[model samples]
Target chain A: MSAEVFEPYQVFVRRDALDAMEHVGTVMAASPEMAVLVARQNFLRRDAAVGLWVVADADMHSANTDPQFFAEELDKSYRRVDGYSDNARRWKRFKQQALQLQDIVRDLESKEG
Target chain B: MAQDDKAARGPSVAEGAALVDLLLQMADDDLVLGHRHSEWLGVAPDIEEDVAFSSIAQDEVGHAALYYELASQLGAGDADRLAFDRPVGERRSAAFVELENGDWARTAMRHFLYDAFEEVRLDACTRSGWQPLQRAATKVRREEFYHRLHSRTQLHHLAKAGGEAFARLEHALADLWPYVASLFDLGPHAAELRATGVLPADAAALRSAWEAVVVPELSELGFGVPACGGTDATSAAHRGAHHPALAELLTTMRAVLDVDAAAASW
Candidate 1:
């Protein structure tokens, strides 16, 4: 008898409501329905997952693996939060000056009374 | 009055024995079927299915352990001894579970049939007045949900696949239907167990419920539902009678523990 061939399915899992689905593993199944079931058994046995997804491996497309795909030729710190550290420092100083002016006004009013 | 009120004082000798009988039937079915499923560990259709099947086998065996613990508390022997030491004639698992795993189609069909019955059975147990039985039933039913899902999905796929897949599944169902009927035989203690609130439904009621849920689904998938009949007493598994396959299964199941007289643990 000839053996039946099964296709590979990539599995994705979400741990909780706030979690994003992450690629966990792959399973072999005759159909997508069977793939979901098998994927649950393989991935959710130990950990509790809020959701699962199974897609045919062949259907998934990936970009070229060349380092240039994600490479940053120059420093990109200017686009990051840490790059705005000067603004945060200036804001803190402004808040302190505002508080000092309020104190000074209160002291002058007390002296006038 | 609530059934729990009737059983609040605990079971009498006969009632306790009846409970033990029911527990053994459940435990033995899970144990044997779990062992059979484990045989497909590395040889299933593929690696992922192998892992999935193995996980299911582990769940079944773990469930058997829980039932065995409950039985031990009810005055049956230790869980290990009761599971491995019993002779073939003393086991209460249905022939459907003890049958050799013939092929993926046969195995899938058997699982589909058995899981459907077990889901109904465990649902009934959840309503049981007995606290431990009810709790165990509730806990095990969660895991059983996945098992039912797995089997039902595969069964539907196979039945609808057409050509050879449909034929194989149809043949498997035909071969297993009669034996599956024997799973509902509650044996001599059925009336007592029902009366004592250990089981919310009698064997016949459970069988009818099973048929109601399963027959339409099978029909929808283009498979014929076998005609229903009363329990076959001659081949009843709960009565300690089993298929020929069970003997060999038990031998292999107990091999490790049986090899040494002094090995205290498994």
Candidate 2:
């Protein structure tokens, strides 16, 4: 069969249940069923995946086509994951305070006994 | 004797040889067909299919190695020697897997039929009286689950496409059916294997179980099931008598070893 009859699909794989489906690559297949089967070997040969999705290229839309779509109109740092980078330090401080409180409570209990 | 006691003690000397024979059959079929499937590596219909065939081929060889390891433990020989050094007459692979991969249609047809038969065979092995074979069968069956899925999906898509695809698959089924029955031939140890519960079913029972699965599905796909019988190449008596192609295939397989007899472990 000629390659023209096949359609392009964007392949995505989830390595585990908690993992997000990451786009691995594109594959050409005659149907969705074939696409999934093909995408499996193409993307998951070395790694066992818990999930896979193949979306038709025609069904996909992206803002990358227009460079202006990604141009920042204002600071949108809050919309990205890096905005919460200080959460690790904050959680560590909170945990230390909580542990101190627990020690004080234990001291009070021992004195009462 | 109870099945547990039998498994605990393992096979008698005769039964050990029979077990080795059975393992060789399974291993040789996988190794041979895996080589055939590997032939499509760069020449498959498309890049995706190339990847699929390559992965499936690797899985088949891996399964073959698993069986060979079991056979080696039973004192058949070194696993590598058992796989690569055996004489053609000693090989127990059926005519179905030994034949050439004529076309994509024939390859797909044989793959579908063979996987279906393998599933039934493995299902029986899962209950084997020999603990090692049972455990190995369980692991192999888990991998085969995806193989059946891939084969059935391909078969369904091609048959449903109708016209050229459907006709090609139909023709392939007709061409392969006579030899496909050879897959169920359990060789000379069928009676003892069954009696010992090493194999829970004999050839006829396994064949019926296999048909019970594939017949309805293939019929629904609009392909006619050809009459089942044995050809000279595919008789139960000639199960170990391999196709001539096997020697050619083995030559190619042994190319690396031929060059360096003491090649480092693969």
**Sliding window of 10 residues with minimal summed lDDT for model 1 chain B:** B230-239
Model 1 regions more than 4 Å off: A1-5, A58-61, A64-67, A75-113, B1-8, B230-233, B236-238
The sequence of per-residue lDDT tens digits that candidate 2 reaches over residues A33-69 is 8899989888888887799999999898866768786
CAPRI verdict (incorrect, acceptable, medium, high) for model 2: medium
lDDT of 2 by residue, B1-266 (tens): 35565656767999998899899889988999999999999999888899998999999999999999989988888999988888788888988898889999999999999999999999999999888899899999999988999999999988888999898888898878877766877888889989988988988888889989999999899877775544423343357667788889998988888888887367
- Could you give the C-alpha RMSD of every candidate to the true structure, in order shown? 4.8, 7.1
Q: For residues A1-113, could you state the per-residue lDDT of candidate 1 as single tens digits?
A: 12355888899999999999999988878888888988888888899889999999789998989989978899887788985769978999999999999999999999999
Which pairs in model 1 have colliding backbones? none
TM-score of each: 0.85, 0.86
Chain B TM-score of predicted candidate 2 relative to the true chain B: 0.94
Using TM-score, give the best candidate's number. 2
For model 1, residues B7-76, the per-residue Cα lDDT tens digits are 4666789888899989999999999999999999989877777899899999999999999998998889
Query: Model 2's lDDT to the true fold?
Result: 0.88
